[model samples]
Target: MAGRKITKKVVKFLKLYYFFLFNIFKLNYVLNKQYKIIFLLLIPNKHNTPPTQAFKKLLNVQIVLNIYIKEHLGGVIHELFYSRNS
Candidate 1:
C-alpha cells in the first residue's frame, strides 16, 4: 500500500510538471510569433521607403508657401479693418 501511494504521488507530480512545461512552451511560441510580427513591421519595405531629397525640398516649399499665404491673408484683413479709411 505504501508503494502504491508513492507511485500515485509520483504520477501526479509528473502530470503537473508536464502541464506546466507544455504551457511554458506554448507561451514562448506565442511570444516569438508576436516578436516576429513586430520586427517585420519595424523594418521598412520597398513600399515604405524614406522620402527622397526632392520630396523633402517639395515639402519644405509647401510649408513655406502655407506660412506665407497665412501671413499675407492676415495682413490683408488687418489693413481692411484697421485702415484710416475705416
Candidate 2:
C-alpha cells in the first residue's frame, strides 16, 4: 500500500511537471512570435531612423529568458531522475 502511494505521488508529480513544461514552451513560442513581429514592425524605412535602444533591450531580455528556460528544464529533469533512482 505504501509503495502504491509512492507510485501515485510520482505519477502526480510527473503530470504536473509536464503541464508546467508545456506552458513554459507555449509561452516561449508566443513570446518569440511576438518578438519577431515587433522586430519587423520596428524596421526603418529609407527615410526613417533605425530601431531604438529599447528594442535592443527587449532582445536581450528574450535571450535571457531562453537561457533561463533551458537551465530550468535541465534542472527539473535532473531532479526528477535523480530522485527516482534514490
Candidate 3:
C-alpha cells in the first residue's frame, strides 16, 4: 500500500480503518479492564444463571462508556450478543 497505486475503493477502505481502528484498539484496552473491575457485573447468586447467560444479562443492563476524546463520549455496545465462560 505504501509504494503501489491503490484504487479509490481500497483508499476509502484504508481511510475508514485508519480512523476507526485506533479507537477499536483503545476500547479493547479499556474493556479488557473488566476482569479487574469485576464487581460491576456481580450478582448475588453466581450459579443461579449459566455463565454465558449471566454475562449476556450483564451486557444488556450495563452501559459501556466510550470517550473518544474530551467532548466526545457514548456507549459502545456488545449487544449483538455476549458470552463468557466460568
**Lowest lDDT block of 10, candidate 2:** 45-54
Local distance difference test values of all predictions, in order: 0.58, 0.76, 0.50
Model 3: per-residue Cα lDDT over 1-86, one tens digit each = 64443364456556655786788768756775673357444665656666777666555543443333312321222221122211
TM-score of each: 0.37, 0.47, 0.36
Q: Which 10-residue span in candidate 1 carries the lowest summed lDDT? A: 77-86
In terms of lDDT, which candidate is stronger, 1 or 2?
2
How close is each model in CA RMSD to the real structure? 30.7, 7.2, 13.3
User: 2-42 in candidate 2: lDDT tens per residue?
Assistant: 89878977886688677788788898889777876776666
- Tell me how far the alpha carbon of residue 33 in candidate 3 is from the true structure, in angstroms, after superposition: 0.8
Best by lDDT: 2
Candidate 3, number of clashes: 0
What residue runs in model 1 are displaced by over 4 Å at the alpha carbon?
1-51, 84-86
Clashes of each: 0, 0, 0
- Give the Cα error of residue 83 in candidate 2, in Å: 1.1
Candidate 2 off by > 4 Å: 1-23, 31-49
Clashing pairs in 1: none
1-86, model 1: which lDDT tens digit per residue? 98986686567556655665666556556655665566456555566666474455545555665566557655754564457334
Pull out the clashing pairs in model 3: none
